[model samples]
Target: MFSSGDLEQAKTNFPEASSRDLKGKLLLPGFIDPHSHFGMMISAIGQANVAPPPAGTVTNFSDIIVALENYRDAFGIKLSEWIFAWGYDETQLAEGKHITKIELDKAFPNNPVYLQHVSGHMGVANSVALAQGGIDENTRDPIGGRIICFDDGKTPTGLVQEISMYYFAGKAIEEFQGKKAELFPKAQEHYLSFGVTRAQDGMTDLLSMAFFRSLAAEEKLDFDLVTLHGYASLKNDDLEFKTYKNGLKVQGIKLIGDGSRQGKTAYFTQPYLTSVFGCEKDCVGFPHGPQDELNRLIGLAYEKGIQIFVHGNGDAAIDMVIRAHEEESKRLGQPLDADRRPVVVHSQFVREDQLNKYRDYGMLPSFFTNHAFFWGDVHRENLEDERAFFLEPHS
Candidate 1:
């Protein structure tokens, strides 16, 4: 290892040694984002942006409408074409309300509009969009999802949650496929601007995995890509673990235990302090599926020697995942594989007691600490004094 004196002497001797002058500045390694969805962000490049302050500053319903209208006009979008927008936050809106189907219809009478919520766990669709998806007032809510209704409980209010969000997102992505080649570079440029050298596509499906591989084969990607295939997507297919190809690699499998905390859908042991739009104060959020099913999936992944990255935001959901890990380890008659390193993504609401359990199970928690800065005050209002202070605790 060369010291500072040797480097200084070399700099003088070489004369042409190009280097940055970092006399008083602190230097650090390039940042790595372990939980970002690079592919999804890329696909959303051309979509209308309605995100609030710090992202786009679309603060109210009127702002969102104007943004969408401006996007439509700027692109000279056809009446038959769908208008897809991303990053609308109901909690941050001035009216503390979500845009309805009627509002979307009023804004774009001829075009179908789908506005995705900031949480990415829900979205609002206009009547045209609903009709396109074959969803109507008579349609029952899908499993682990809800179609928010009016006071009469018959007419849908346009907001769709959980699985329903996925259904609409799939349709939007299908439309986005035609423009992928053009948008991919834009997405990569956006990430590069933030100094991101390596990116992860957190929950990719089989089709997405293929697309990423194609990009790698064509030598289009400039940065390293690690993709975690969705567990559901691999159930019917006969796909095995793939190592590094170009700068791309199949990292692991992804499983979502619950939904978002801001959306009042993250499963919790206790009820939230205040009532949200659809859920009551007494309501504790529900899990995506039973614990046994999650356990089976975890066990199957472990047996196959594939790493699992579970999305568990709330304490209750974290508990369920931890239980599954414990059970699997016990059945195998040994501790978990340290190298595999099963991860609990967005472990925001983990409790004091759970820290020990995570250590015991050799589980790694990737906390979404950004929430502490962006939505801390909102969490305080929803969860009350005690729970709010403990959120994203340093200890």
Candidate 2:
């Protein structure tokens, strides 16, 4: 029971003490965060909340239309803009073809519409957003990404995946930048309330890093922060790796190797359950890291003392990361350190053999368990015999 004067004196003497006043229960050896995306978490909190289709109705596309209508009506949304919705599962939709742009236009004739997949990696925007993004029939897909278009006249049917969705959503993010920063303190407040004393600002770069540094220099950092700047950028040109040290160690590089299950492009070895009518070969998800480029990047990251944290949501992609790590270790003539424990975030589809390799290489896995409850059934349907069964298994 230290009084205000005693607390003030202690704070004055110990400037690095996180809490100026001790008002809560102090637990010994408290919480440590292995992984998190604080910026994305803040963005998610800011997005509009639309109710998902009822459990039994998800497999039917018409039911999704009904839910969308109900949601739009409930909010009294205007007809001029698109009806934006999130958490739609296309795997369960009727015919599993997903609600096409034509379908959305029919239901909400006056308004354009966009429905984001539950995975946040893919989405179907109406003709309005397609036009807004200047994505016409001739717009070529970006490297390592895809733009799903229609046949015959070759119109963009609004289905865009991976970074291609960036053409639209990234602009929205840029527009909301100032507001997003306003929400940063509130996100930090939530982290502190949950007893998260230390955190890694995962998947953020450039402007976001600048914002965080400004806050830190002003002595407003809410937690002991470790910012990770290598997300999607395999080169140091984007990461500015020389600027990191002990106070904020940028020791790891994050490589997004594939898409997620909900996005239906996780790059599995086998065909998806929804890929019917001679579509087996074309049904696989996109791969960010091709064989040769991945090897070069792995070697570069290793030589520079930057640990690799690859994101793999399918067996094929996981195999890619494992193979690169194998070559890296073999070339170096030694295994990585256990204490450092370079990680693979959202490692949801590693095979049984990969677990042993992980153990052998002293790699830690930060699984995205959030999907285990939300999309478990869809996973079971699509990857029943595949390697997804052991995701987050107890060993």
What tens-digit string does per-residue lDDT give for candidate 2 at 1-395? 33345766887877786863457855455367777777655654444443344533445667667867876787687776546666666665656666777877778777656666667677787777777777878888786667786665467778888777876656545544677667878888888888887777666666676776777677777677776656455554545453533334454676777887656667667667655321346576767758767777776777667777777777788788778777876776656543346677777777778777788778777756666777777777766644456766522
lDDT of 1 by residue, 1-395 (tens): 23355776877777876788899998665567778888789778889999998988799889999999999999999996899998888888998878899888998888989998878888999988888877887988776777888877778888988887777899877888778788999888888888787789988866677788899999888888888887774464455465777888787889989888888888899898776556645677778788888998988888777889998888899999999988887887657534568888888888978877777667888757788778898889878778778886633
Model 1 clashing residue pairs (backbone): none
Top-TM-score structure, candidate number: 1
CA lDDT of each candidate? 0.82, 0.67
- Which regions of candidate 2 deviate over 4 angstroms? 1-31, 51-97, 103-116, 151-153, 192-195, 231-251, 276-278, 330-340, 385-388
The 10-residue segment of model 1 with minimum total lDDT is 233-242
Runs with alpha carbons beyond 4 Å of true place in candidate 1:
1-27, 233-242, 336-339
Candidate 1: lDDT over CA atoms?
0.82
TM of each candidate vs. truth: 0.91, 0.75
lDDT of 2 at 145: 67
